[model samples]
Target chain A: MSEKIVITGGTGFVGTHLILELLEQSDAELFCLVRAKNTSAEQRLHQQLAEVIQGSDYAPELINQVKKRCHAIEADLQGDITSLATFIPSGVSQFWHCAASLNYEERFAAEIYDINVEGTRKALALARALNVDCLNYVSTAYVAGRNTGVILESPMAEVQSSNVYESSKVEAEQLIYAQQDMKYRIFRPSIVIGHSRTYHAINFSGMYGFLRRLIQFKGMMARVQRGYLERESIRMNVDPDVPINLVPVDKVAKQAVAIARSDSSNTIFHLTNRTVPTVGEALEVLFSTVGLPPPKIVQDTTQYAWIDEKFNEK
Target chain B: MPNEIFVIGTGRCGSTLISNILNHHPDVLSLSEFFTFVTDLGTLIPQAFPAIQINGAQFWQIVSGIYAKQNIMLAHDIAMKEVLYPFKTDVRFNASTGVPAILQTTLPHLTPKYDALFDQIHTVITARGMATAEAHYHALFGWLAAHFGKSIWVERSGGSLRVIERLYQHFPNAKFLHIVRDGRDCALSMQRHNGFKMVLLVFQITEILGIDPYESDDRSWQDDLPDELISFLPESFSGKDFLAYDVPPSLYGHYWSGEIMAGLDVLDRIPAAQQLTLQYESIPNRHPQYH
Candidate 1:
């Protein structure tokens, strides 16, 4: 039988990339679960797909191909669960659960759980209802939380998460692994950024968020205090040594699709970049990106704040 | 004791210093840069309580709804916590932009517990049902004046003089204080200021991406900004290697000239009794607000 794939969050950055990669690699029929309220699901997916492929290696051609082959299954992840079964077609060979709430703010705890945890449960429920062959769960490597040392691609005992979103994903992972009958796979990607080769990233979260804010800040200070740039060095509290695993969108999609295509059932794959960049290096790139003065890394803050810049005139 | 006054002038002038002097006065409550260039102006405030009394809860939410700092940060895709609530180990107090900058510099002592301060102000405002950010400011100023037995309230922030027309719409009977600085000096100062540079870059980057940050819905420019601009944005970037890619001083000069003319026009519209103009050279002569 031909490979019949059903995916959620297919209109998102990673989802779009995964769709394009799958279209190039496989002859499977793809169903993308997109939340379409005002516009049609296909219309929303097309617009998102167009945005994702802009300035990439395959521009119009690949997008057009996916547009023709891909089907937009209308379903809201945070919406009614029973309605999901009605939206998604029956007999889905594999259900790819990629949709998630990435908000890490303290205020978004309820919404985060609603989408990340309950949404995953509903997706898994839909998979079980359809009696799908396997459910591929897209997770984040940050689920490793604040723990140090190298992490192997293996089933981990439920541990504390770095943030609320991470914790929600951990809950979702537990739900999947706890399943007694169904075969499931978990793919955890670390800090997804722009494309590796082209640097074409559709979403502007994570590193982009940090960099964009930093530049705005540097510029603001320079304007508020004309001599802001004249300062010898700027400083942040981020650790100097820990490596931040940043994988490109395309790389994550490529590796993820490769693993999803395998026959192995309950395997966990870490879709991470080989050469991880340090937090110091990341901050360096950020300050440098806007041509602003770099801050000297200081582990001690109280003495410096109270003593060095007495009047906060630094 | 709600004697409203505003210090209007082209940015990069001595407006901050003047605001400082006004702030120190026991009879004056100074609010620096309440309204200026921002993506979200809390537009919902103006029409919110039109000719009606808003309850405390309803009015407080409106005032706290759109933090100008939060808006600017969101516009730049930055998290407010990065600057507003710097981590425990963060030595330097880096409150990045907008009204937050005023608070960061003027009240640096609040840096360690700025969030606590914000929460307190939020609680106080919500308790009384402040209608808008303006209303919240007025309320804060009222409290300040009441605490210090001051009757006059003055707001000063650089470049805010450009938005005098909007201010006039809101505060028609409010007094206007104009501090005129040399246009050339203002331009040079602006060219070096990071905020001015950012505005220049935002304009250019928007032009390159064909999206206006002010009016357009196109945010693709954020991702498409030239690599040269982003070259040294890293924290470990060499301090000595920092080279400013600021727009020409002439552009800033043009901005200053345009703002001065516009600000002057707004001042002219206000009754002569409520308008005061002071030259930069006449600073030693002292001003009415000072005494």
Candidate 2:
């Protein structure tokens, strides 16, 4: 008999990639928890998968496999989630909880905690009630915020988080640690981008968002003054020598699934590139790719030019 | 009987010196930069003078809250020379966490112990109930006159002539003091002044863009800006950079002429008893005669 797997956040970027990876990895039947009211959960999940597959340029066989082995169950983590225990079938060997809110601003602090910390508690409770063997969590490497020098893949110490999102994840991870009834695994990936080969992403955020803003500035400058960007350099506030840890989504999904498949329960994994590009090196590539002048990495804010200040505001 | 007076000019004139001189008078409560704190950047635009009634807290916020443009100036240390707020020594507030509007010039110039004065004023003002803007201002000024043992209060603010319409609308019965100066000399003085330069740049951009870029959310014309003029825009330029950029004296001279004409157009409507006009050059020689 094949194993049964349950997953949440099937509509998200990382979750979508993880689902595809799981489908390719094992003969397990996948049940995805989707947030839907008017529309059917299957329809919503299929719509999301179609968009992601198109953007990612995945092979045609993945859709047929998803249709055959995958099922979508309508559920909201914030609502009466006790009913989820009934909907989720028994003998579900693995529970993958990947849902999280990425907003870090103070205005969204409440929502971030609600969707991230509180949502994780509900998922953990459901997993416990269902007597799932192990829980696999998808978290960010940034939960080790404000700590410098080599970070270890062990239990995290009490440290200051730079943003609301990081702090919420820390709390959620702590919540998992207190659970003694079941085993849990945490995957911390750093700045997950598109697949290395396709270089396409359904979500245009993080590094992609920065690139989009740079393109906008380039277009604006070209219209304002021809050859202006070529003559003048845009200033980026960053340490030139500091390495920016970025990992491709496919690599993260593959590593996470592999780790989950093994008997590696109650462990933390760091899903990041072995060698990362420095701020200056990455900026050089981005500027050249957009055919604009290389950025001047400025650490001192007092020395910021008027244009630099304006762009920083945006 | 207590008398209320307002000394108005196109700033960079002799208003600061006049206010300083009046500060010494035993019987007069000199309210330096009072109107400046009330209105946004000495602007007499109708938006600055909403006739709506508000509670004491709202009024306090209006008079105490630092405007965004003013915050930029304070943050960059590009505030006008007349601003005597002890930012370096003040403990509670700074440029980043904004110093109150009244504390910027009005309260500090009156006394070095501005913090205590601020606390006292806050207690009194915030305790009062809802009232018209005019009534609230009069109540505060009247209370100040009584507290200082003075028979009258005279308010003076730089570039106050620009806000003649506001003053005229609010204080219909009060006496007006118009100080005149040579447009060329005023323009020369204003050319080097960072505050004037910033205000002029904002107005110029508003005129050229046909939209108030700072106030409006529309960025459809972001690409329509002239390259040379784009850097001086409020969003694009910091206060320090703006201070370094040189605006022509000719532009200030033209601005002075227009201000004088517009001010005269409003001042002409009031009674002769309420209006008094004096030249900037004659003040030094005729000081004793006026006193």
Candidate 3:
């Protein structure tokens, strides 16, 4: 049989894209690990594959082969993971672990570790049990934490994360390193945006948060626009100049699969945009999208302090 | 310690705006979301020596816990699973945390020396023997005032008016500033905010479990509450019909009316001088800045 490969988080945004890229690029039989929350694994797998093909501009022949070769193994990485051993047999050639809990809140620090760290550990364990040849781990560039300046493509050590999610991913990387016996390649991608050229988003996060806020802020100002209610100024605390490295999801998948396919072992690669957009630029687009004025990003709480007060009134 | 002021409102009433104006005075210390923080951390109260008496180390523990649990998680989706690591040297104490968000947003100069200020506050709180959560409140206010050279501190937290009775019981001498907003507008706003949704869910869960949510000693609410409900607490539970009772979006009107009545009910027990009502409509919109 052609080289058999198993992957976790196969139904997520990045995972689905990776599956399609792998299907077209390689002649490999793929066993995808999917989570079944309320639906059966087969149905979720179908939906995940269907969404990709529907969104992509790939040929019908390749897309058809993409659906046929990719098999689904239903499992929850955060749940009783022992059940994972049932569907797949031993000696899988390659294992790509791409699952993560992307929540950044300090309150969710614990859950982030549970899913990102523990889940990675479990995936590694399953890889070992199956005696996999190579393990490809997908991580984030944010594992650099709050550090500024250029981050080298190397193992991050003695770093402090501003939030729990970053810290948890850092811990996951450490956990992987601790298992020195395994041959693994880590792919660290910066903030994954939609398709580079199409701009079609399968999942909305990061930049989406600002866009959604614009819409919500508009709702607050909607009545005022109609002259039914008086307008109120909202005080926000965002620093407009912060730079965000937004990487296209398509590019991330293509590069990640290429790196995984390479002979390099225990190497780290940063898949990021060459020119990143600043927070100021992102906000401009966001405001225009929701038909609102460019937000008065007020850092002076004393002069514009009423902004927070009025904003929170809702 | 100087006198304490409490601003109770259903939110969307611009109490924050009032606090913003008041905070311009060097003598006035605005404790944004102060009571809300206490209420969120009230679970730790039972562990206090006398149901609320926490020492300096314990006080600091609560402070860091607030950063980890409350401040970090205010976004509604934040959940603290197993990583409750103590306050680190590098982590920022900024907008993500409840009270600090106000300071970080308005007064950038106020923070840089935040850690030193917190240490000083911890020393004073720990030095005193707090017998009740009210006692801790008194110490907190005093520490804040003395540290900032402010003689008066006003407590401002949106939606705090829902549990005004706790404030009345704890700080009887405290002045209450009631801000009222148009219920319809507020109701429409509530349906969109994750914070408001979480507040309503907690209230609903407490009602279902038959426990007083505001009371610190009612620990059984956590035990009696379903796992599904508990799971939702860590994340924003969007499903309306999942709970024992379905909370329709329209109920926001009833919620607003109920809170206004509750605030009014609590106002009756206080002296006329101690209670003041500020209608949101009274404030004129002079700013044409909003589009």
Best by lDDT: 2
Worst 10 residues of 2 chain A by lDDT: A219-228
TM-score of 1: 0.56
Candidate 1 per-residue lDDT over residues A32-90, each given as its tens digit: 88898678998989888877777466656887677677988778888765555666566
User: In model 2 chain B, where is the ten-residue run with the lowest total lDDT?
Assistant: B282-291
Judge candidate 3 at residue B215 and give its lDDT. Answer: 35
- Calculate model 3's interface RMSD in Å: 12.0
Per-residue lDDT for A26 in model 2? 95
lDDT per residue, candidate 2, A63-172, as tens digits?
88888878998888877675688887799889999988876656668888998999999999888888899999998899998988888987679768998889999999
* Candidate 3 residue spans exceeding 4 A from truth: A220-242, A298-301, A308-314, B1-291
State the lDDT at A175 in candidate 1: 91
Task: Give a tens-digit lDDT track for model 1, residues B1-291.
Answer: 579898888876777668777777777766655443222222222433344555556554543344432334333433322133342233432323333332332223223455455566667666875254446445666764564477887876557775677677667778888888888888887766655554554444444445444444455544444444432222222223223454567668656766776667777788999888887656875453322
lDDT of 2 by residue, B1-291 (tens): 368899998887777777778889999889998777556575334445558888899889888877766666777788776677866656688877867888888888777788888899999999999898888888888888887889888999878888888888888988988988888888888887877877766665554454666567566544434455576655776655576677777657656766787789889998999999988888755453222
Off by over 4 Å in 2: A37-39, A213-231, A288-291, A310-314, B1-291
lDDT, candidate 3, B104-133, per-residue tens: 222222445655665566677667653566
